[model samples]
Target: MIPEQRRDFIYRYVHEKNVASFNELAELMNVSHMTVRRDILALEEEGKVVLINGGIKLNNLLKLELPWREKAELNHDVKRKMGELAAMLIEPGQTIYLDAGTSIFEVAKAVAASNCFNLTVVTNDFSISHYLMDMPHITLYHTGGLVEKRNRSCLGKSAANFLSTINIDVAFISSSSWDLERGMSTPDEGKASVKEMVLQVSKRRVLVSDSSKFGKYAMFHICALSQLTDIICDTALPDDACQTLAAQNLKLHLVSTEREQNHA
Candidate 1:
């Protein structure tokens, strides 16, 4: 398997099994103990685990990771609000750049509801593209690239080249992790390149992330925290985080996390 695919498999296995030892992984992937150790070391460097005596344990204090689908489910209410707020920023007869992440896809769903006339939506995410295909009122543009099955997204050189050619009114993106030090990040270099493209095309940029993203850093850097135009997060965040973002000269929006049923 390719290195990226191998790493992704290791991540999926570790997160699913709560692995206790390198031996377990070695047996599961049909690899040797030393190979398993190398995989664990790689994951550990990305802040995914803590090695211990002859074993490994996921650090409870470390960032939480969910499957692509499960992540979309976790903060549905907040994401919807974030999506609405992102869409509200849209102007008719303008073009936007959409990065492929759950939060950004939520923004597309919200935008689809609005069906803003004469607005162009450009993206590399298959799920978001399919979502907008039926919405005739909004013009949709897609980039060609190899598809990622889990997230149903596209990436690589072609997509990057496509993004380079278009200037956009706004770009709404999601993050794997965020911290003042490393800024916004992702585990995959391929996706990070796509994000770089989003930044390149956007005249104005917005980052749509949740509370879970704050105080964390991921593998690949897309851009520095100061580069963000605004950050939209849920109200459940701490004051210190809000202060930190403001200190970076970033506008912040706090959306309600509670579902409508609970609000009622």
Candidate 2:
């Protein structure tokens, strides 16, 4: 099919479902996943639909995107709620850690919006640091390391080593995938180990994730649900998974669906 035809199909599919996954679009247009992805990329450049995790959704033009990758788009709603809950745990003057994830950006937003000024934030995500820059009272410390362009974060042995030295009050982590039976995991081994180090130095390790992470596994395992002191998530999470975490004595903080979020 021609590119014009494919573009039309993309619009049609998105209009019908409000979301279109790469695989679904490929099937509809009888093309390859790479073709679909390329089309989505072109569309994104054209200011059309926003390409998310294997999918596309109508763009929210008003909000300037904060260097988000496709990997972070799967559970957008769940991430917002988790961010709110994570923010509530932060107290004034506390030292906190925020990992590089879309959900974690929400945590950054919540913290920045609050009046509390006596907190130090350590982060590897450039966007998170950028978001907190205007907030006068928050002290920002970045992990000095090689920057990963796709995720827009610092990751390397240097970054991991830097995190090992800092003792923090609480660390809010985000992951791409999780397995209750196995552990929390991520696609990049270097970044996964960075998360592990962040948890090690923090007094309270809070896992902030969405329901889409459940039942999935990544190449590198970070930490187990058992290792987390608590988890914050939205209502889309499965009850069975929650029960599994509970059996491991992990405290689960379920966020209310009604909590307001800064939508994308």
RMSD of each: 6.5, 8.1
TM-score of each: 0.75, 0.74
Give the alpha carbon lDDT tens digit for every residue of 139-214 in model 2. Answer: 9999979888878899879999999889999998877567776678776777877998987898899888766455
Model 2 bad stretches (over 4 Å): 1-67, 71-74, 256-264
Task: At residue 71, give the lDDT of candidate 2.
Answer: 42
lDDT tens readout by residue for model 1, 204-252: 8999988766666656778997887988888767888788887777788
Residue 39 CA error for candidate 2 (Å)?
A: 12
- Can you list the residue pairs that collide in candidate 2? 93-118
Q: Against the unseen true structure, what C-alpha lDDT does each candidate score? A: 0.78, 0.77
List runs of model 1 lying over 4 Å from the truth.
Answer: 1-66, 259-264
Which number leads on lDDT?
Answer: 1
